[model samples]
Target: MNNLFHSLLVFATFLGLLWKIHRAFRRASPIGDGCVCGGELCLSSP
Candidate 1:
């Protein structure tokens, strides 16, 4: 029982980390400068 709970906890934590990383990547655009306001394009870098 204890081992199962421990395994589940580890798995949940791993999933949470993966989710955070996914969100971060989605927030930052790969092409050009990363736009913060979800605008169509960034004309210049700050």
Candidate 2:
């Protein structure tokens, strides 16, 4: 039971890290920037 709990904790931490990295990349991406500009052209240009 203890080992299973530990594994679950580690898996959750790993998923959190992945989520953070994904968010960071999404924030930096051109598509994200284009959305702020509010046009289909902006999205298509990038």
Candidate 3:
């Protein structure tokens, strides 16, 4: 019984760490000034 409880505690901690990493990646964007190879396009037209 004691060993079972210890294993469960370790598993929960690992799961929490994975959740944090997943959230961090989800919040990141893939596009930015450096990411674009083409020159900037004007958003307004005269």
Candidate 1 TM-score to native: 0.62
As for candidate 2, its clashing pairs are none
- How would you order the candidates by TM-score, starting with the best? 2, 1, 3
User: Which candidate model has the greater TM-score, 1 or 3?
Assistant: 1
Q: How should the candidates be ordered by lDDT, best one leading? A: 2, 1, 3
Query: How many residue-pair clashes does candidate 2 contain?
Result: 0
Clashes of each: 0, 0, 0
Global CA lDDT computed for model 1 = 0.64
Tell me the deviation in Å of residue 34 in model 3.
26
**C-alpha lDDT (0 to 100) for residue 22 of candidate 3:** 47
- Number of the candidate with higher lDDT, 1 or 2: 2
How far in Å is the alpha carbon of 16 misplaced in model 3?
0.2
| Per-residue lDDT of model 1, residues 1-46, tens digit only | 9999999999999989976775576557564434443444333433
Model 1, residue pairs in steric clash:
none
Would you estimate the TM-scores of all the predictions?
0.62, 0.65, 0.59
